[model samples]
Target: NGQSTNSNEKKLAFQNIPRLPREVTPFASFTNVIELDQRGPLFQGPGAKRDTGRYKVRPTDDDSMKRAKKFSMEQSVKYVLVRQQQHQQRAQLDLIKKQQALLLMCR
Candidate 1:
């Protein structure tokens, strides 16, 4: 009895299934319109490729470039100062070593 009842319930459920293609017609038309809009025009004259909008132009302001150049200059100056300090320390060490050697010889 239970098996027969389950089969009848499944048969009733199958009767209510909706047709998909008919319901999706509006969506298909919308997608078709979008595809038509995306396709660019054919028959281009000579040198027309340069005028196309494929490559979007960026802003003309050079603020970022100027900032990058300033940062590079600041880094270079820091490196130069650090190297100069290292050289000065090395020179001082050499002078101290020479004085120590002279004192040892006097002894």
Candidate 2:
């Protein structure tokens, strides 16, 4: 009776083994090669038109405008600094001239 029970348990274990579908055999073949006519942009879908011009225009113009504005702001700031330095130098020269005039009168 014990031998019979052991045989039944072995049959149940064999039935529990996993199986793949018969249509997908392990010996099936696959290829990685694509035909030349089928090659196009990877992200684009089948039968979709490519728009090359629209993507090229907007970002370049925006970058140039930003660069121009930055250049103008830098030029204006430099001009203001030069003007301040010139004014300060002129004030110092005027002070020196007034001191010289006072010394001449004292003599």
Candidate 3:
């Protein structure tokens, strides 16, 4: 009787196992994240036959070329402004030092 009851229990357990939900659909793909698309030409080299090289042109290069003369003048103006500021700051500090020395000598 005990052996028969154990067999029935085993059968009951086996029946419960398949009732649980199974994977209806397959897992999502990982190819998109794993394989990123390149931004440039596939192949490029001096010895190679093809000239497909991934070379991204910098925005700064394009900007400089588009406004080469304007940028030069603007850069000159900026340099002069910075130089003037530095000279003014140095002159003020020198003036302050001279005033302090003069006061000390007078005292």
Candidate 4:
């Protein structure tokens, strides 16, 4: 849990950003979540870093499960995109004859 103060100085998320001394960044493990940043930049304004990525190291099993979840999500999105494209193409083709008839009548 972390907390911070907003412009109004109101109490906020108790989470804090994790940072390692420059001297220790090299030693930091990529898998070890070195930082915990929650909802900070969103309130930080333009100067605040948006979509800041934090690093974390999870167990190898957890990593695989995460990958599987991500892969399934991405695959579903791709499948939908392809399906939509096919539907759109079919619609265009189906409408072509009607468009040609309208053009002939207009001429």
Q: Give lDDT per model, in order.
A: 0.83, 0.89, 0.85, 0.77
The residue-level lDDT of candidate 4 at 106 comes to 100
Over 4 Å off in model 2, which ranges? 1-57
Q: After best superposition, candidate 4 residue 44: deviation in angstroms?
A: 58
Q: After superposition, how far is residue 61 of candidate 3 from its true place, in Å?
A: 11
- Deviating ranges (above 4 Å) for candidate 1: 1-61
As a TM-score, model 2 comes out at: 0.46
lDDT (tens digit, per residue) of candidate 4 on 1-107:
23433532442333344667966787755665578668645455677657768767579978898999999999999999999999999999889988999999999
Candidate 4 lands at a TM-score of: 0.39
TM-scores for all candidates? 0.44, 0.46, 0.38, 0.39
Q: Considering summed lDDT, which 10 consecutive residues are worst modelled in model 4?
A: 5-14
Task: Provide the global lDDT of candidate 1 against the true structure.
Answer: 0.83
| Best model per TM-score | 2
Model 2: which ten-residue window has the lowest total lDDT? Answer: 49-58
Q: What C-alpha lDDT does candidate 2 achieve relative to the native structure?
A: 0.89
Q: lDDT winner among the candidates?
A: 2
Winner on lDDT between 1 and 4 is 1
- Model 1's C-alpha root-mean-square deviation from the true structure amounts to 17.0
lDDT of 1 by residue, 1-107 (tens): 99999999999999989767855766655434344454766776886756546664356546766788899999999999999999999999999999999999999
